[model samples]
Structures are given as C-alpha cells and as structure tokens.
Target chain A: MLPDATLADYALRLGDDSLVLGQRLSEWCGHAPMLEIDLALSNIALDLIGQASHFLKFAGRAEGRGRDADSFAFRRDALDFRNCLLVEQPNGDFAQTMARQFLFSNWQELLFAQLQHSANDTLADIARKAVKEVAYHAHFANEWMVRLGDGTEESRARTIAGLEWMWRFTGELFERDPALKPLVDAGVAVDVPSLRPDWEDRISRTLAEARLELPKPRRWVMGGRVGHHSEHLGHLLSEMQFLQRAYPGAMW
Target chain B: MNAELPLKDRVLEILSQVADPEIPCVSVVDLGIVRDVRDGKVFITPTYTGCPATAVIEAAIGKALKDAGFALKVATMLSPPWTTDWISDSGREKLRAYGIAPPDRGTAKHSLRDVPVECPRCGSRHTEEISRFGSTPCKSLHRCLDCREPFDRFKCH
Candidate 1:
C-alpha cells in the first residue's frame, strides 16, 4: 500500500481541481446570460464543490490532520494549490465558460471513470458517486458547445476564440507526476496519461458535432499540478478565502 | 398501535414523516434516501453529491429520531450511489399528484437522450423540456405544450 501522505497528496490535487472550478462557476450565480443558464451554472458549481468537500475531507483524515474540507479550501495559499491552470482561468465570456467546461468536464468524467476502480476505497467510493454527477455537466457543456459553435456567425467566431484560449491548458490535465508513479503501480492511483486517447476521441467527436476545428496543441504546458498557477488563481483565492482569513472560525 | 410496533418499525414510522426539505411532498424514505436502520443507526445516502439538502435531510432525520425518544445516529453512505429508480412507487404517485413528473425507471442508459415526459397537469405526452436543470438539483424544467404549464420533472441521475 502507498503511504498515507502520498494518498493525501493525490486526493488534494483532485480536490483542488474541483474546488477552484467550483469557485469559478459560482461566479456565474447571478451573472449568467439567462435565468436558465444562471441556475444551471450554479447547480453545477454546487456539485463540484460537494465533490471537493468529500475528497478534501478524506485527504485530511488520511493525513491525520485536524484540518477538514473547509481548512484545505480556505487556508491554503495560492502557491500551495494543486489545481490545473485550465480551471483557474477567468470566465471570459459565456462561450469561453462553456469551452472551458467542455474541455475540463470531458477529462474529469474520463478520469473518475478510471478512478472508480482505484485500490484506495475512499477515492473509489467518491469517484463512483462523482462520475454520475459529472455526466450531466459534460452533457450540458457539450450541448452548449454544439449550439454556440453551429449557431450565428458571431457565436461561431466567439466559440472558436474561446476554445483557442483554453486549449493550451488541456495538456496539464494528463500530466504524469513521478511522485504518484508508485501509487499508480499499486493500483491506488490512475495512470492519467492512459486517458488521453479516449479523451481526445470524445473531444474530437464533440467538436465535430459543434462544427468547430480542434485547436493545435501548444508547445508549452502549464504546471498547476505542482503548485505553479496563473495570475488568476491568487486573485481567486483572495476572494474565496477572505471570510475565513479575516475572522477565523467565523460561521453563520 | 405505534407503541405495539417493534422498535425498528417505530423508528421507520417516525422517519416516514420527515419530508425532504426541498421536495416537501415526499419524505426522505419515499425518495430512498434512507438505506437502512440497524442498531440505533440510520444509514442514508444523498441523491446527489452536491445536494444542499443532504445536510438538511440528515438534520431532520436526526431530529425526528430524537423527538421520538430514539437515540439513533444518522450516517451517510456513498457506495451504491442513490439513483432516481430508488423513488418508491407511492413516492412517484405523490410527486405526480404534486404536479412534478416522477423520473422514469431504468432511464440511466438513455440519460442524454431526449426521453418523452408526460405532463403531470394534463397527462399529455406533448411536453418539451425548457432546461435540463430545474429549480432544484434533482429536477429538470419542462413545459407541457398542450396545457402550457411549466413543471419540474425529477431528472434521471
């Protein structure tokens, strides 16, 4: 069995991805293009946040720390975060938001599908429940990708631009951290690189249905998985952690 | 009659009165949230991972059991994740009577497909979904073309 520290680190990385993305989506609570979209985005945010809580809570327990989901979420500094840069990108426009969701949800769904069989029972259990919720998220994003991509000229142009901007960060989602090699070998973690072909096929099919072209792969990849992040993550954390930092243990 | 029942049956009877905070027409038990009651413990599962009502339902169940003088601990189980198919037949009837279309059983296979929904108000097959999401996480917004009434349909998870 892999050490508890390794398992906690793995859980933290997964939890941070959900936590950061959930925060980004919650930004659309009252600001989405339409009422239906506002509710949909918020619902998706809630689901991601919920998934984050479970993963973070398990991480805390495994690490034998008194900290919990909230602590890991609110107390961590930007340099300590482990989310991919894709999720931390600002929601540029409705099209941009949908593009980001399409890319990330597709990858997340594939990752969880494999993680459900992990030798780690807690991670597997969380993945089993999470896979169901993420399906709807991926479906929602894919539908919008098709609509916006195939819609009016202005919509198609915006959709293309959105995909281009977010496409660079896609590589980081499948990054193979050497620290996790042992866990992968022990069946406690997934071989994330193995998910690429299936993810590519799924993304290609969706883009095709949307009448959009796949953006060329970028030469440089992001390193958010190793505590490196874009400028936006620091700004995001300030807002997300303010209540906790200002008045410790403040509660309603 | 309540006093004559076994402790487990009595505990379940109390639980049946605990309505889902969001869908007030249905109890947690009716929704299959309560998986089991054993040794003074109530094992339940949330309908969705991020459902806000999860904490609320747990609290309600805890209160219900406490009020009945049963010191039962409410524990959440995530394995065998909750499915819409768990909604009891009577629960389905209650949801429809409340003007919310209950989810079709065994629809997980075709979740992304546009399955036809029957209008709870007029029982018409002519219903169109307004949004895949609804006022709550477990439902979708739909409008009956014939009756022109917008209603919530419990979505297949």
Candidate 2:
C-alpha cells in the first residue's frame, strides 16, 4: 500500500500543473494581441485555474492536511511544485507562445481523454468535463500554428524556433513517478508511458502540416514530478502566492 | 400508482424555475448551465468564467432549488469549457434584445481577420472596434457608423 502522503503529493502535482499553466495563461488576460484571443486565453486560464483549485482542495482532503486550495497555492515554495516542464516555459513572442500553447494543449488533450475514464470518480469527473474545452484550445492553437507557419517568412521562422525551444520539455509529459503508480494501477490515471507514441505521432504530423520539423533530440530534462523545476517556477509561484500569502483566506 | 405525483418529477419542475440572471427570459437550464439533477443536487457551470454575474446566478439557482423542495449542492464544472457555441439560438436572441449583437458567422476571418466587424444594432457592415475588451469580458466594444451608436458585440471566442 502506498502512503497517503504519496497520493496527496500526486494530487498537488496534478493541481500544480493546472495552477502554474493557469497562471501563465492568465498573464495574457488583457494582454493578448487580439481581443477575441484575449477572451479566449482568459477563458482557458480560468478553466485551468478552477480545475487546479478543485484538485488541490481534493488533494488537501486526501492528505488529511488542514489546508485549502489558496493555502496550497500561496504557501508552496518552488521545491514543492510538480507541474511538467512544458507548461512553465516562458510565453515568448506571439509565435513562440502560440507554438508553446500548441504543443502543451495537444499533450493535455490526450492526457485528459484517458483521464476521463479514470477509476477514481473525482479525477474522471474532472477529465470528462474538461476534454471538450481543451479540445477547443488545442484546435485554436493548432490553427494558428498552421497559419503562422505557412503565411510569411518571419512568422515561419518564429514558429519553428518556438517549437524547438519547447521541444525539450516534451519528454516530461510521459514520465512516471512514485505517486502516479497507485492511480495508474487503479486505472484512475492515464499511464504516462502509454501516451508517448500517439502524442509523438500527432505532434510530428501537426508539425509536418505546418512545415515545421521535430526538434533534434537533446538531453531531456526530467523530474518535475518529484519537485525539481526550472528557475522560472519560483518567480511564477511568488506572483501567484503573493496575494494569498499576504492576506490569508480572503474572499470578496 | 398516484397519477398526481412522483417526488423527483415535481421537484425538478419546481427547480427548473431558476432564471438566468443575465437573460431572465430564459431559465438557466436553457442556457446550459444546469447540466444535471441527481440525488437532490444541482450541478451547474457558468457559460463563462470571471463573468461577474455568476454569483447572482448561483444564488438564484440555490433559491430555486430550495423553493422546489430539494436541498441542493450546486457544483461548478470547468472541463468541457464553455464556448459561444453553447449559447442557444434563443439565448442569442435574448442577447440581441438585451442590446448585444448575435454572434456572426465567421467571427474570425482567417482571410479578413483584420476587417471591421458588422454592427448588430444598425446592420451596418461598416463598424469599428472601440476596444478589444468590452463592457464585460464576453463582449467587444464596437460602434456602427450608420446608426452612429456604440454597442457590445458578443465576441466569437
């Protein structure tokens, strides 16, 4: 039997992925280059953040920790977060950000599809409801990827570079850690190892359609599942945690 | 069999009375906010997040469910995120009458993505965007030259 701590940690890991990416997307709330795109990004951000809150709160309960979502979000240090490397990479230029979004949303779409059938009813419930929305997001980003790639020389260069920069983080999407073992065994989580082949095939095809290439394989960065993260996470956590850290349990 | 009553049926009928706070002519169910009724719980999700009007809608749903004789635990779902696609045609009409334009076909013209939006109020194909962000997050600020009136356009998101 795995420890409750492991399950709780895993829950936070999932929650953190949502939270951190949610925060990144929220940065575009009013700042998107296009108005509709602004609403689109904000809507996606809101969904991700909301999902994180639910999972984090559930995680707190499972851990028997006397904490809520806000506390978990605001109080965590960098070392405690467990989101994948792909989501936390900085949103670069529009093409870069779009490319990053394109890759992450595709991976997330596949992840949530299998997640929807999870044996753990809560995770399944979240996944089933989220699949439709993520599908839209994935489609939206992909459309732009294709447009930007085929449109002009500048747009093509930016898209290609953006995808390459983001490629290293792709490896983490399929990683397995101690915490996911139980959920995977229970058939309540997508076996990360199983998703890679299809994820690769689709990404490869999507890039080819856009006239982009699969980035050359480099040393893949791993271990975000166990709390090791890039430097960017600390700054993100600081911003996210600031308000709640300053004012505990505040609600208007 | 009592032709007069089944507890759940009567209960749902009463609960269905909750009207959307944004567009009162239609019930929240018509807006697709109320997804399910099970074990005396009302499961609901907003058509959009940060909508500002969601609190009032939830309160109304709560009151409606209670008034209907069922204790309700209203759950908010975020997956399968809400899109403009979910807005019923009737809800779109409610939006038009409420002074917002119904969503136009090809909200994004990959071809003319930069072109002017047609005004819903005046039917002027000659309209200009005043602000990308509108009076609310869901709307975009637009003005029609023909009517020379400013109005909100339901963004194509």
Candidate 3:
C-alpha cells in the first residue's frame, strides 16, 4: 500500500488538474463565441471546481494537515501545482478551447470511470458523481469538434490546427510515476499508462468521425505532474488567487 | 417552557420555506435536498454537484436555521449523490408548471443522448435539443417541434 503521504500527493495531483482547468475555463465567462457557449463553459468550470474541492479536502484529511480546499487552492504557487500541461494551455479560440476540452474530458472519463471502483470509498463516491459530469463534458466537446472539423474550410483548418497544437501535450497525461505503482497495486489508484490504449482508440474514432486525422506525436513536453508548469499557470494563479491573497479570511 | 415544535421539526419547517436559488418555485425540502435533521445538524446533498447555486442554497439554509433560533450546522453528504429521482412528486409538478422538464427517471442518468425530452409548455413528445448546455449547468435547451417553444430541461443525472 502507498503511504498516506504518497496518497495525499496523488490526490493533490488530481485536485490540481481540476482546479487549474476550472480556473482556465472560468476565464471564458463572458468571452465565449456565443452566449449559450459561454454558459456551457462556465458550467463546466463550476463542475471542475466542485470536483476539485472534494479531492483537495480529502487530500488534506489524508495528510492530517490543517489546510482545507480553499487554502490549498488559493495559497499554492504555480510551482506547487501538478496539473498536466494540456489543461494549463491558453484557450486560443473557440475551436482550440473545444479541442482542449475534447481531449482532456475523454481521458478524464476513462480515468474517473475506473476510479469509481477504487478501494477507498471517498474516492469512489467522488468519482461516481464526477464520471457522470465528465461524460457530458466529453460529449459536448466531441459534438463541437465534429461540427467545427466538418464545417467550412476555415473552421476545419482551424480545428485541425488546434488539435495539432494541443497534441504534443497529450503524452503527459498517461505518464506513470514510480510512486503510483504501489497505489495501483493496492487498487487505491489507477495505473496511468494502462489507460493510454483505450484513450487513444476513443480519440482516433472520434477524430475520424469528425473528418480529422490524429495529429502526429512530436517531442513530448512533460513536467506538470511534478510541479513544473507552463508560464500560463502562474498568470492564472495570480488572477484566481488574488482575492484570497489580498484579503485574508475573507468570506461571503 | 415555551410553546414550540421540536428543534428538528422547526428546522424542517424553516427548510421547507427555503427556495432553490435557481428554481424559485420549489423549496429545498421539496427538492429532496434535505437528507435529514439530527443532533443539531441539517444534512443536505446539493442537487447537481456543480450547480452554481449549491453554495447559495447552503448559505440560505444556514441563514434560515439561524433566523429560526436553531444553531444547526448544515453538513453536505456526497456518499449517495443527489438524483432527480429524489425530487418529490410536488417538485415535479412545480417544475412542469414552471416551464422546465424534470429528468425522466426511466432513462439512465448518464445517457445524455437519444433520450426523449418532452416540452414543458406544450407537453409534446416532438421536442428536439437546441443545445446540451442550457442557462445553467444542470439544464439543457430544447425546442418543441409542435409548439416551437424553446425550454430548459433538467438534464438527467
């Protein structure tokens, strides 16, 4: 079995992924291409934030630390975050945003579905709720990918380019750190690498249906899992954590 | 001794008056979010884990309890996640009457596609989805083919 410390770290990685992506999506509140799309993105952001709270809260408890969800999220520096690089990338355009959602949600769906059966009941319960939400997220993103990819030439070109830009980061999603091995053996966590084949097949079929080809994998950029993040995350934290940082113990 | 209902009963009474922040037509108790009241605690499982109103609902419940002279803590329990199946029959009526279609229980909650959505306004079975995302996270937009009325649907699950 993995030590409590390692399990807490695992939970932080999961929590950070949701929290950082939630912040990124929330930035589209009033700026999405359309009003409905705007609400949809914000709604997705809300869900991610909610999921983040559960994971972070559990992590704190496991660590026997006094930190709560708010402190963990609002106090952590970018160097302390562990989200995959794909999620922290800037939302380039409508197509690019959808591409990022499509890729991440598909991977999340697979992971959460498996996590629902985790040995730990808290993790399982959270996953049971989250898996349903991510399924809709993936469906929404896939539909848009199809519409944009098979639409006009300009849209198709932009959609493909968006996927190409995001593809390099996909490699990091399935990286299995040696620390995760014990958790995987104990059925407390998933083996990240084992999820790759299924994730790849799902992406390939969806891309084909969208009339788009899978972008070739290039040199992989990986580091976010161990707290190394792109520059975008630092700027994102500055905005999201500003309120709590500026006013200590502030509550509504 | 003062004449009043028990603390649990009083808490329930106050909770019954608390409206869902988004759907103002129904009370939180009627929505089946109030799981239980025991030991000076009001346990609730917020509907739609990501709904923006979850916090608002919790705050509203806390204020209602405090105003009623009950020092009860509102605890959130996610073990058995909230479901539309928990919505009372009166809550369903309120939703339909208020122009939003409640989730169809027979369909699996996770199946977001091909599920038949009826129009709340016209009661027509010919409704089509306009967008999976609606005005809120827990809803979807649909239009009735017959009435041509666009309405919000409380997406199943």
Candidate 4:
C-alpha cells in the first residue's frame, strides 16, 4: 500500500471536487427557475457537501495533522484546491448547471462504484455511501438533460450550448497523475484512465437520448488538479470561506 | 424485560422509543438505523447520507440516550450502508397508516419506475410522481388518482 501522505492527497482531490461543486450548486438556492428544480439542486448539493466532509475528514486523519475537514475546507486558498476544472466552472444557466452535473456525476458514479471496494477501508466505506447518492444525482441530471434538450426551440439550443461549453473540461477527469500512480497500483485509489471509456459511452447515450449532438472534440482544458483554476473559483472561495476565515472557530 | 440485563439492552429499549424526526410515525430503531449498543457506545448507520434528517436522527438518538441516564457515544458507520430493506415491517405499516407510501421491496435504484407505488390513502395502484424530489431528499412527491391526495413516498435506495 502507498504511504498515508499520498492517500491523504488523493482524498483531498476527491473532497475538493465535491466541495467546490457543492458550493456552486448551493448558489442556485432561491434562484432556480422552478421550486421543484430548486429543491432538487439544493438536495444534490447537500449530498455532495456531506460526501466532501467524509473524504476531507479521512484526508485529515491520513495526513496525521492536527487540522480537520473544516480547516482544510475553510482555510485553504484557491491555489491549494485540487478539484477538476469542471466543478469550479460557473453555473452559467439552468441548462449549463444540469450539463455540468450530468458530466461530473456520471463520472463520479463510476469512480465511486470502483472505490467502494478499495483496499483502504475508510475510503471504501465513503465510496459505498457516495455511489448511492451520486446514482440519484446522475439520474436527476440526466432527466433534466433530456427535458431541456427536447423541451422547446430555445431550451434545446441552450442545452446544446451548455454541453459544448462543458465538454472541454471532461478530459481532465481521466488524466492519470503520476502522484496517484502508486496508490492506484496498491488498489487504494481508482485508476482514472480505466473510467474514460465507460464515461464516454454513458455520455454518448445520454446526449443521443436528449437529441443533442455531441460537441466535436477540441483542445482539452487542464490544470485544476494542480490548483490552477478559472477566475470564478477565486470569487466563489471568497464568499464560501468568508465566515470561517473571518471568525476562526465560530460555531452555531 | 429483566432488570438484571445489561445497560446496553436498556439503552436499545430506550432508543426504540425515539421517533425519527422527519417521519414521526416510526422510531429510529424501527427505521433500522440503530445498529447496536455495546460498551457505552450506541452505533447507528444513518439512512441517507445526504438526507437532512440523518443529523436530526443522530441528535435525537444522542438526547434519548443521555436522557435515559446513559453516557453512551453515538457512533456512525458508513459502510455496510443502511438500505430501505432494513426498515422493519412495523415501520412499513406505520408509514402506510401515516399516509406516506413505504418503499417497495427490492426496487432497483436506477429504475425508479420499475415498481408501482400504491396510494397509502386509497390502496390504488393509480399513483403518479409529481416530482422526483419531495419535502426531503429521501422522498418523492406523488399524487393518488383514486383519492386525489398528494403524499410523499420514501425513495427506495
């Protein structure tokens, strides 16, 4: 098995993706186009945040540091985050949001399914719970993808635009970092490269069902894994981390 | 029922009376979340990790244990995850009586439409989903065509 430090970094990558994405989705609260959709988005966001806590907490323990999940989440600056670029991307519109969710959750569903049986027991346990939640999330996003793509002339155009805009970032999720190689070999972490084909197949089927054409392959976006991000993430962190940063140790 | 039984058994008995915060018709024990009580620790596996009600359930369990004069730790286990299949038969009956459709047994999580949800009020198979989400994440809102009543159906996980 790999060392605890490597395991912690791997966990942080998983946690930060959920944390950033959950924050993005939470921005939709009180603002989604409809009440049912609003509640659904918020519910999915809550599940992501819960999953974030589990992974981050595990990361904290593995790091053998005094810091915990809250510290890792609230105190870290944008440059320290390791989420994929897709999650940190803005929620452009309802269709864009669903498009992002559709892509990310589908990948997450597959990843968690494999992680549920990881050599690391805690990671495996977290994956077991996460897989069930993400299944619902992916399904929810898929339903919306179909609805918006087939809904009306305007919605169809917007849904297609959403998918195209988010497509470039999809490649980064499957990039196998050298840092994670040992853990993957040890069976303590997922081999991300192996998930690409299944992700592509699922995405192709969903796009076809939605009656939307797949965006042509273009230049792949990169760098969120090593902490370079779009301008949006910095602004998001300022808002999300304000309370914790300003009042260190404050509680409800 | 013997007084000589271990304190853990008494704590379990107490937890059996603690109602689920969201679904008042059933207790935490009946919901199958209370895994065990041993050596001053009360183990519980939350039903839905994302469900807002899990925290409330844990808090309620803790309060109940403390109120019963036990200083047990409420430990949460995420693996061996909780499933709808764990809900007791009595819990299912209570859910139906309370107007919420209980989860159908062995329903596949991906194919939500595979099993028909019977109306709790009229026992009609003519129910339709109004929304995939309900007041809580664990439920889906449905309307019974026969009774013309809208109710929440616990989502089968």
Candidate 5:
C-alpha cells in the first residue's frame, strides 16, 4: 500500500496548485480589463476550486485521516504544502501574472493529459475534467502571451521581463520525488521526469509564437515536492488561512 | 451514425440541434459538452464560466429530449470544467461559417483577439472590440470598421 504520508504529500501538491492559482486569479475578479475577461477569470477560479476540493478529499481518504476537504485545505501548515514554487509567487503585475500563467498552464496542459489516462480511476476522472479546463486556460494564456509578445514594444518588453522573473521556478514542476515512485509504478501518478520534454516544447513554442525568447535556463530552484517552499508561500497562507483560523468553523 | 445506434445515438442526434444560445450556430450535443447520458437523464456542463444562458441550455436540452420521446433528468457537473477544445470540429466550422471566430483550447499562451473579427454583416475582417461584454455574458461587442456594422464576437472564455 502506498504510505499515508505519501498520499497526503501528493494530495497537498495537487491541492496547492489549485488553491494557489485560484487565489491569484481571484485577484482579477472585479478588476479584469473587460467584463468578459472578468467572467473568464471567475470561471477558471471556479474550476480550480473544484480541483482543489477533489485532491484534498482524496488526500483525506488516502491519509486515513478523518479530515475532510475543508480540513485538508484549511488545517494544513505552511510547511506541509506541496504545490509548485511557481504558484506561490505573488501576482506582481498583470504582465508578470500572465507570464506565470503562460508557463504553468503550459505545463498543466501536459500534466493533466497524462493524468487523464492514469490507471487510477479517481485521478483519471479528475484529470479528464481538469484537462478540459486547462486546455482553455492554456488557450487563455497563449492568447495573452501572443498579445504581449506581439503587441506594442513596451508590452513585449514587459512580457519578456515577466517571463525571466518566473523562468527559474519552472524547473520545480518536473522535479520528481521518491514518494511518487510507488504511485508512478502503479500508474496512479505521472513521472515528473516524463513531462519534461513536452513541457519544454510547448512553452518554447508559445514563447516563440509570442515573439519572446526564453532566457537560457540557469540553475533552477527546487524543493516544493518535498514540502519545502519559497518565502512567498508562508505569507500567502497567512492571508488565506487567516479568516478560517480567526473564526474557527465559520460558514458563509 | 444514426441507423446503427440505439437510444443514446438518437438522443445525441436530436440534442445536437439544440444550438448554443450565444453562438446559435452549433447545437450543444455537437459541441461535445454533453459528457454523459444514462436512463433518459442528461448531463451537461457549461462551455463558459458564469454563463447566463445555462437556463436556456437546460431548457433546450429538456425540450429536445422530450421531443425525442425521452423523459428528462438533467444534471450539470461543474467540476473538471468545460473547454472550447471540447467544441466539436463541425461545431467550430459552423461557428466560423456563422462569422464568429472560434476559441482555441486553453493550451494557448496568449489570449489575443488577434484576427480582425469578421463583420457578421459583410464578412470583412476589420473588426475591433467596442466592449468585452455584449448582448449576453459570453460575448464581446465588436464593430467592423469596414462595414460600419457592429456584431458580437464570442469572447475567448
């Protein structure tokens, strides 16, 4: 049997991805450049929340903990989060944020594609639904990238700068942990290593299409797969978990 | 595709005629957003977020199923979400033929309304967005500069 810690760890990563990204997108809830875009962002937020719920519930099950999705999401410590480093990075500016989406959405596109075919039924169902959403997200990111890359010179420059800022964190996405080995062997999880090339190609193509050049990959920062994260995540969690912690068992 | 299959196929065939309320060019079934159907029950999720046309879609699906002699049970699953990629190839062609630019899948890096939206009037590709919100929540109001005709461009959402 896969160890309970192993399952929790995996669940944390998936949940964190959805939770962190959803938070970021939620910032645009009212401030989108246009109402249609506003609705679009909101829709994406809804999907991520759904995904977070799914993974957290599964994690609760795998851990044999009596915790539910809310507990898994709200009760976890900062050190326990397993989401990629890319998601926790704050929304610096719209350009910076879209750049983040461009990178992560590209990776997610492939990740979900593989997950949809996983031997595990729940993972497959989750992936199947997520792939459809991510495909739109990938489209949204791509459209924004093309606009920024192919738009006015200032927009192009900003988009490039944004990409540079987030590029190093991209490596964390493919960093495989030993915990994933058992699930991977059972075809329940994707080998982070296998996703590397496709992720690169897709990102490269989008960047190239956007008329933006990728910075030569430098020494990559890593460790989120093992529950280690950047300084940013702690601050984010404090804000998100604040309300819940402040008023325990509060309901809207 | 029709003669060989049973109730599911017939239901899908009829459901395909239920046009997308905003686009109006392709039926919901042909759009492939109908994920599952069992025992005369219909399961569909929206193609766009916060889509207000959901009521109309449910109504259309209900009406179409009833027309086909199936009693209705419809459920909408919002999880995993729906994407334009799920829009069928024929549906996309129908959209383009109806003079609306089709939405690409989410894997795209940028969300640019790059191509000049064709004027639903003269079919000229010199359109510009007047406002992102249009007559409905799922579209942007675009005006074709050439024809001085305003039309709706289905927003990339």
Candidate 6:
C-alpha cells in the first residue's frame, strides 16, 4: 500500500503549486492592462484556487488530520510549501505572465492528463476534471504567446525576455522526487519525468509557430518539492493568509 | 402531482425548479449538475472545477429539498467528470433564448475543427472570440462580426 504520509506529502505539493500560482494570478485581477484581460486572469486564478482546494482537502484527509484545506492553505509557513519555483516568480509584465502561464500550463496539462489514470481514486477524479480546465488554460496562454511573440518588435522582445526569465524553472517540473517513488511504483501517482518529452514537443511546436527561438536553458533550479522556495512566496502567503490569521476562523 | 410520484422522481422534480445561479434560464437538471439520487442522497457535480457558484448551487439544492420535506444529504461526485455534453437539449435552447450561445455538441471534435460560434443574437456565423475567459469561468467572450454585439458562449469543456 502507498503510505498515507507519502500520499499527503505528494498531494500537498500539488496543492501548493496550484495555490501559489492562483495567488500570483489573482494579483493581476485589478491590475491587468485591460478589463477583458483582468477578467481573464481572475477567472484563471479562480480555477486554480478551486483546484488547490480539492488537492488540499484530499491531503488533509490522507494525513488523517483534523486540519482542513484552509489550515493547509492559511497556516503553513513558506518552508512547508511544496510548489515548484516556476509559479512563485513575480509576474513581471504581460509578456512574462503569459510566458509563465504558457510554460506552466503546458506541463500541468500533460501531468494532469496522465494523473487521471492514477490508482488513487481521489487524485484520479481530481485530475480528470482538472485536465479539462488546464487544457483551456494552455490554449489561452499559447494564443497569447503567439500574438506577443509575432506581434510588434517591442512585443517580440518582451516575449523573448519573458521566456528567458522563466526557462530555468522548467526543468524542475519534471524532476522525479525520491520520496514519490513508492507512489509511482504503486500507480498512486504519476511518473512526472515521463511527461517531459510530450511537454517539450508541444512547447517547441508552439514556440516555432510564434517565430520565437527556444530559450537556451540556464542552470536549472530545484527544491520547491522539498519545500525550498524563493523569497516571493513568503510575501504572497502573508497577504493570502492574512484574513484567516487575523480573525482566527473568520467566515463570511 | 409531485407528491403522487416516487420519492426520487419527486426529489428530481423539486430540483428541476432550482435555477443555476449564474445562468438563471437553466435549472440544475437542465445543466446536468444533478448526477443521480439514491439511498437518500443526491449525487451532484459542478460544471467547472473552480466555478464559485458550486457551493451556492449545492446550498440552494439542499434548501430546496429540505423545504420540500425531503430528508437527503447532498453529495458531490467527481468521477466520470462533468462535461458540456451533459447539458440537456432544452437547456441549450433556453441558453440560446437567454442570449448566450449554447455549447456545440461534441466539443472535442468541434474544438479541433475551429468551428465559429453562431451568434445567439443575430445568428451570424462570422463571430470571433474576444477572449477565451469571460465574466464567468464557464463562458468565453465572443463578438458577432455582422451585428457587432459582444456575447458570452458557454464554452465547450
């Protein structure tokens, strides 16, 4: 049997990725360039948050803890967060946001597609629904990538810069954590490393259509799966967790 | 008449009166939100994983059932995942009448063909998508070229 602790840890990692990314995207809610863009980003953020709730709720159950999704989301310190380094990076500009979305959503869609077949019923169920949502996210981001990469000279430059800023983090998405080996062996979790080839193909094809050169990857960054994160996540958590922290079980 | 029917049928009848919070033209049944009812429980699924209206819909359903004197617990089922194909034909017509383009049947195939959405207002085939994300998560914004009217389409999931 796949250990409950392992399952809880894995679910927390997945949940944290969605939660942190949702928080990052929500920052665009009132700040996007146009009203339509603002709504689009917020809608996506809502979806991510929704997905995060499911994962965290399941994580709590697996851990056999009295804590719920809110506890995992609002109580955990940054060192306990297990999201990848890619999602926590600041959304620099329109181009950077789209680049982050494009890279992350492409990998996420692929991961969820495979995860739908997981032996764990809850994870599989969540993945089945999430794969559909992530498909739309990927499509949305890919459209923007092409538009920005092939648009005005200034837009193309920005798009290139955006990809360059986020490329190093891409490698960590496929990293096979040793702790997850038992789950992978038991078919309770996805073999994340197996998802890389398809991710690369789709990204390469999209980049080609955008007339943008593939970024020359720099030194790959890792450790988010092990709870190591950039400085930005602490600030994000403070803002997101403020309500629950201040009120102590505050409810509307 | 509802009282004369079987318990499940009566419960379903009551639920059919509960309108979707966002799209008032359609009921929970019309949208395929109610999956099944058995063993004093109503199995429901949300149209979108992240739709904020999910809790509202569930609460409303629970209230409607309770008010009708049916003792049942609302349960959410995620397996077999909800799809736009589940929306009833009557639901599609109601959506069209309400000015939102109903999703085209067989979304998987339609999406690949890059099918242009027919405008709910003018029936124009020359509609272009304005934004993939709309005011709601389940919709996409589209503009009719002929009428120049922006409308929402219940996007194919």
A2-54, model 1: which lDDT tens digit per residue? 23888888999999999999999999999999999999999999999999999
Candidate 4 residue A4 C-alpha distance from true site, Å: 2.0
User: What would the per-residue lDDT of candidate 4 be over residues B48-88, giving only the tens digit for each residue?
Assistant: 66667888888998898788778889999887987888888
lDDT accuracy of residue A205 in candidate 5: 89
Query: Comparing to the true complex, what docking class would candidate 2 get?
Result: incorrect
Worst 10 residues of 3 chain B by lDDT: B1-10
Calculate DockQ per candidate and list them. 0.86, 0.22, 0.66, 0.73, 0.14, 0.78
Say which candidate scores most in lDDT.
1
Q: Which stretches of candidate 5 lie over 4 Å from their true place?
A: A1-5, A33-37, B1-157
Per residue, candidate 5 scores C-alpha lDDT tens digits across B1-157 of 4567876777787887788887677888766678887865778886553355776898889887777778868887655556556777777677767766556556323434365566665877777877544555445567788888767665554
The alpha-carbon lDDT assigned to residue B58 of candidate 2 equals 82
TM-score, candidate 2, is 0.77
Point to the candidate with the largest DockQ. Answer: 1
CA lDDT scores, all candidates in order: 0.92, 0.74, 0.87, 0.88, 0.76, 0.91
Q: Between prediction 2 and prediction 4, which has the larger lDDT?
A: 4
Please report the interface RMSD of model 4 to 1 decimal.
1.3
Supply candidate 2's per-residue lDDT for B56: 88
Per-residue accuracy of model 3 over B1-157 as CA lDDT, tens digit each: 2338776666777788999999899899878899988876889986666777988999999998888778789998886877777788888889999999988775546557677788998888998887888887778888999999899987777
At residue B31, give the lDDT of candidate 3: 80
> How far does residue A133 in candidate 3 sit from its true spot (Å)?
0.7
- Give the alpha carbon lDDT tens digit for every residue of A99-209 in model 2: 888888888889888988877766776776566556666877887888899879999998988988888887888877666677678786678878888878877887788
Model 1 chain A weakest 10-residue run by lDDT:
A1-10
TM-score of chain B of each: 0.94, 0.74, 0.89, 0.89, 0.74, 0.94
Docking quality tier of candidate 1?
high
Clashing pairs in 6: none
Count steric clashes of candidate 2.
4
Candidate 6 segments whose C-alpha is farther than 4 A from its true place: A1-3, B108-113
The C-alpha stretches of model 2 lying farther than 4 A from their native spots are: A1-3, B1-17, B22-25, B35-56, B64-157
